[model samples]
Target chain A: MNAGIRLMTPVALLERFRPLFEPRGVVIAGASSHPGKFGFVAAHNLLAAGYRGEVFLTNREGGEILGRETLRSIEDVPAGAADLVFICTPPGAVPELLRTAARKGIRAAFMATAGYGELGEEGKLAERELATLCADLGIVLAGPNGQGIVSTPIDLCAQIVAPIPPRGHIAVASQSGGFVQAFLNYARKTGVGVSRAISAGNCAATAVEDYLEYFADDPETRVSLIYVEGLADGRVFFEKTRRAAAKKPLVVFKGGTTAGGQRAAASHTGALASDDRVFDGMCRQAGLTRATSIEEAFELAASFATHPLPRGPNVFVLTTAGGWGVVTADRISASRELRLMPLPADLRSAFDARLPPRWSRSNPADLAGSETRDTVVECLDLVASHPEVDAVVFLGLGIQSNLGDLERNGPFYPGHGLERVVEFHARQDTRYSELALELERRHRKPILIATELVDCQPENPGPATLRAAGSLAYPSSHRAIGALEHLWRRARRSTAA
Target chain B: MSAGAPPAPSRTLSEHESKQRIRAAGIATAPEMLAADVAGAIAASREIGFPVVVKLCGDGIAHKTERGLVRLGLADEAAVHRAATDLLAAARPADGPVGLLVARMIRGNRELIAGCLDDPTFGRCVMLGIGGVFAEALADVAFRLVPLSARDAHEMIDDLRTQAILGPFRGEPAIDRDAVATTLLALSRLAETSPEIVSVDLNPLVISDGRPLAVDALVEVRGR
Candidate 1:
């Protein structure tokens, strides 16, 4: 039905989205004095997150919220005072307020009001009226029952949510507001930065496809993460997602596959496509990586943000222990896209010359308890530069530091050269983390680092160092292998396209 | 079919009619002929070769094998005549002017299924899967939206879990992927052009000498 919107060019779509994502100023309509109301919380969050733009709040009864004075009506504000408006009023007041805001040159709106579309037939009719009005007014609408939007480039957190995430290159868009917040919370817990994020609640005026198309050409976004429950038009979603994937990696997680889940989705989004098999086929055809869970989706997006695309499927596994190597090799063998290549003679001989006599000189190249400070990085350089290897999964990062912990806690701590040894161990671990990123950039291949992160001490230098360098040390070998497989699939799809 | 007219009630087409429609779309089908009488059936079988298959065919007779109206491996003219006579006698009045279908009996080790359906969300979609008696039980299949490109056809074929069967299996050569892709592409075009066609099912597309031949098919159309 919205055929004209689909025909817009990517450049034009970017400009259309600019006022919503990069607005010069914003007006919070229906601003409340109560702390629990969304009207107050949205303004509080905008001010707390340090939004660097002119913000004007409006209430029917003029008052002061936080510190800014509220106007009696949106008409009291000057024309061109703000380009975006945040509506926290009831559903009945949204249409008239939007009309007034449009007259004042506000081209974008985000509605935090509920009680429409998700209620029933009457609610759906009301939702349709709002969509028609917004279309006629030439305004880009985000949601009628949505949470909010975040733009890190402008240091904007114009939402009713808490915890503005650190700035990075991964952009998130989801049909569920909870998922958008969950991804951002994970970003904060980890050190991954977010460029922009949105929760497309009810999606009455703007669908998830429009956001995907914008992210495709957004210079700040290197990867996009999406969580979808249903779609209004599967073909349009496929086309836009395919176009986006051709430029950068797009990771998707689909919900509502089972019968019970499908019923929930029908009520949740109002239009459900129930065939998971067809959805899987669409993913492969469109070159989008389908993640099985939320954690996997985030990890895949993180991998794309931090690492380079692997040139091929040939993977090399390097481990300090025999079991980690064996498990990693098994996982790679089970994968459809990755292959564990046999170690060539030249590379094997190079490892033999550098490593100790008891090394297990095979594909895994188990260190056999023989490792010095220079051993890991030297062996990594040898394999990563070789023509036979496309990616490397280096396991067991905190081995040396683990031993250092014991000596520091023991009786001889800092007594006879123990302090110097502990400091050297920590510095070496951090250096290793930084060097991995450098090697990945120099060789144009992915080098994933894995260590035990669960129940890990907060002061563990290996993972903390990786986080500081804007890289991730995967918690297990399986996760590392999974991220590497996604990189390889993206590279293959890019080549095919 | 007129655009403004209401759609007619949907019904199944006979096996022979379905094969004819698919063959016209550049898909290979088993060489067969329709006969009205026992003598005509015997002559058609002889022209096709010694060993053949015969079935009572009509629009109303959808499940012939289940109804015991199908005869397989008729090695001679006498067998074809007896089978044709018995099939004709076995048909009920509700079958409505049934005829005997005589065709060559082809043997193959590998079988694949290909078809199209009008999905509610994605419109027409082409499907490829492992086919045989266990097709429903195995449930190994992949799909793509209609109007498939050559690359899409190949990728859908590769998407199937039965990759071993696509290669050399049980003393047979590797299945002809190009031939399979051509069949899928043709079905895509047929689905795109024919709005009245509701669904097309080509089960057990038998691979004889590395080439897929549509030994049996059923096409559902919008009108009686």
Candidate 2:
């Protein structure tokens, strides 16, 4: 472990990864004119995403692709013209093409080809050979059967997939290409942009741990989300993850944890130490937040990206209705990471003066359907600024907006001065969303606004406004609490460390 | 004797030897003494006080309880002598040299297991879990790669799902968590220092009066 630390110093790792992530020039080998091939998609996405760097294309019989002239071969490309190459050729053709690219001074290569280790014995042997070759040539290889790479900082979406996510600070890496794409899709839909996303297909040369180490120090990355199936070396993974987690939060979701997937053991201790249990222990020891599901993993990543690290586990749940508060309070009671801080005398008195007499007057602070725009915003500020609270989950967004939608679309259209009433409600919802962001900044506490977002229309003013403000109003109170629990656990682990 | 049979590849240490090995590494075990004869067993039991356990002890005798070579709750000198005679009589020809292990009879409602194993992927790892006859059935365990820090030891104890049992239970005090952590740390160090030891099972580290005392232990070592 000491040797690993000495060999891969942070400065050395950052330097090693600069060309792959922040390349000055990039080349697309096997660039195709056909719109169907991965070769064409790789080049097209790179160009379309507005990568601010020189781009070169090469093919055996190259002429023009996306209006850029393509060289006939890697040899035709000028030396030092590009520092990175995306190999989109067949598996058998990759080795020779990589050799030519290495000669052409390409320091990094991403093999966007398939048919490597995912096959059986023969494919594994070939993958090992490719790894050895990359080491010998001193070329940083990303994948032998990967989808591609997306580095938003460089405006480089050099992948075979579509929908480059909006720019944000979460770096995502996955052993499964499809899952990486799924996370990117979530980012695009939720306005939760990613700083970097990579599909570590086969991980022949550059494994997931390498990316984790880089993201640990990557200036643009604030959080990392990873999806793993199995590890080649558990101890090495544990050490690297522990080091990375000390610097930034890491959200992990692993597959194949059931009893059916466990290996047989010879001793009593070994029998009880199932793969899942060991992995769980590793996560706790390394201070990584292990999510049980894919959605939870992404939500945790989003929370880390948007919210400040909570000072402690004391949580304040603010709601506009009674039922939302009731269910959310129940969740807090069950959570091991967070506590529902009781409403102190001073804050209770303040709420008593402003809120209706029917209010529950507890930790949830149920507003009981008697809140105006000013009262809601005031209550949020009161709770956020209170010294006892570390975080707040504000439920009941989109309520007024949804009501406005119903009234505006109903039969008494503009009859009872309804037009102005609908407009006022929409404006109030948007203002509350913006105020949540502001109060969060001022108090350095997370104020997670949630509503039944799945039931809301695409243009619902509440969620739309939060998204436009570069934040997210979660879909439900359960999800909001779950995300907050992850954040608090991460904060506690960091504090303990 | 015929010189044709080869010795066993690996051997399970006798209970006396196993306890000694772990006790040297700072693990607490029940007070006991190895007696070479019935008279010696009576003397050892007297020193250990009333209500002692006498078991057949030898390297060749691994599963003494299954073979009916163990006698528990011997309250006096006559009981100890009778149990010791029966155990020695039950010993088989293959048992080689044997002795009587007289230990203070330990009783507890709660049991915990602590051991170390050479995992195929994670290498040497120490395990802590709820123990007893239903240990495998309950399957509540936590593991850490060996050479555990103090923090790791405490966290492992906290990771058990049946945490209610760790608290004050059945009119007894809460299990001494720091003592359990110490035992885990000791096992971790023992595993690190003794690579020849393939695995160690200290099941039923019986909790009595809020403290853990190992009543039975088996240390499986590689090669004779």
Candidate 3:
């Protein structure tokens, strides 16, 4: 709340960037014949993503790249034929190439060229001139020195190296191109599918806020995930992200929330702000959930896409072991965003018939090891049936079934020892997880399941199938409770629209 | 927007003048009368009843309590006479015009803060926080962009870090949240429609008998 600062915003420049995200046709200005260059990889990524648009390639040598014939220059492409252009030329050559693309009526340009604004004073001057040129021609440029975009709606993957991810509801936009690669790597490792990923570098004309506003309107995107380094115009950033959060949850990994981190961000993305605490206040005002790490950001994203928002703050943890229930109950109690609801009389009565009398008749609803598969299913249904309970955290799913011990038991040790019996258990576990997913959909409340072992265990496909059905499984009850807390906190924010 | 002219700039508003703006916005302030003499102060105190506070009020006199110009708990006529003379003698206006203000001392259970400031990043923003001596040290406050809805105002009050202090504390009733929301929404409207004001700082908005009363306020004015 600093005074004497200009807070007027008569116009928001990040509006109407849909064509940048969902382009009709594209031209790669520097499609190189060499496989090592970025131009070649950019072209290859588009093809690998299964983009349906007519892709025109340009090279000075006038040859072919990936079986597509190349034009000697970009001017040869028909005017108004291509909606977007990827400038893969050097920094010095980008300005002239942008003029040619603008002359050809290209509406948006993704500049993969480096050394602009991020290098030094000379580069900054080049960036300033290029920024004016693009604005005058009414073209929204993504970057001057950056990585590229991965869009699922058009299958438009213009980035390098990282393969096209599956189409899902979470969209990502980051200031650091390298970190966007890391985000993709993390997404793949954690089974978090990305609908769109853009690493906007330098942001000469198109900024991180531009994609935020665009994704806010994208029907394919349910949660807009962001990694911001710095903002040239903080008001625009706050307004756009706030507007987007009103539509869906915004899981932000704001990189400069501390003094040391702000200094690093200035060196990294050239950000400027008086205090990071003011940014924190702005997030609260805008109703955004700020994540401390990339993993939390992804976890929040997956939770939003996979599960409906909880109706209230009360969540129930149903565990087979009393210890897991105690640990998860502690985690849930620690967060003000969520608390354990008392086991209602109806649920208590329902559990009395199925669960043994030794069951903990409290909020955690410990099953007390009397849970057969039938009892587990009934307990989950009971948890989902309650009106007072908002969400459920069920522990002891996969990897707890001891597949590794069956390996050590030489294939003939009783329940899951033989190969056929193990397969039967695996199939039954998969069906049980799928049933959990259906119950979640039927109740329209989040059911965050926890497993003791990592998913994709030796032969146990339970966790993987659960994850595939959008029932996210965490390795510990703490992480599961954390995810549920994030979900509930966002669900309770005022819809500031 | 009604009959009252917007507060004048080129100087800060006196406590009486500051309360006028908040009073015009549908909030409650204890009724009082200004007295220039000890005899007049005693009569005003009789009307305001016992447990009244006498203060030296004037332009640029924002911190009367720190200057020892404020005397609280003036229980009788004799005490009011002594307090009136002390405040009148200490009162000196650095800008122009000075006087003595005799007001009803509001009794309350808990203290809170409600305010409005123009933020560069989010434009006009309304704030609610745990107020008193530890307001700055704790820094436990929540803000929302102005032109707020009724829900936004309530959410600002609910977003405070010290929720335990606001509700049913020490065998007292909860702070009247609806009244707080009304006050905040009024300030938001004031900040939105009247550009002359820079900020409104109401510290220790005490929960007086299950109600929020602005006991002390300063409205900084910089004409638009």
Which model scores highest in TM-score?
Answer: 1
Candidate 3 backbone clash number: 0
Point out where model 2 deviates above 4 Å.
A1-6, A259-274, A454-458, B1-10
Candidate 1 chain B — worst ten consecutive residues by lDDT sum?
B1-10
Better of 1 and 2 by DockQ: 1
How would you encode candidate 1's per-residue C-alpha lDDT over B1-224 as one tens digit per residue? 32123445899899999999999999999899999999999999989997999999999988887899878899998899899999998989999988999989988988899998866666678899999887889899999887788888999988888788899889899999999999999999999899889889997699999999998889999876
How much is A108 displaced in model 1, in angstroms? 0.7
DockQ for candidate 2, please give it.
0.37
**Candidates 1 onward: DockQ, in order:** 0.45, 0.37, 0.14
TM-score of model 1's chain A, to 2 decimals? 0.96
What is the i-RMS of every prediction? 5.0, 11.3, 8.2
Quote the true-contact fraction of every model. Answer: 0.49, 0.46, 0.17
Error of 1 at A3 (Å): 4.3
lDDT per residue (tens digit) for residues B45-88 in model 3: 89989889888777778788789988988888999988888777
Please identify model 3 stretches exceeding 4 Å from their true place.
A1-19, A30-72, A78-81, A114-132, A160-163, A229-239, A274-287, A312-314, A333-339, A385-390, A403-421, A455-460, A485-497, B1-11, B37-40, B87-96
Residue pairs in steric clash, candidate 3?
none
Off by over 4 Å in 1: A1-5, A409-412, A454-459, B1-8
Ranked by DockQ, top first: 1, 2, 3
Candidate 1 falls in which docking quality class? acceptable
lDDT of each candidate versus the true structure = 0.87, 0.85, 0.77
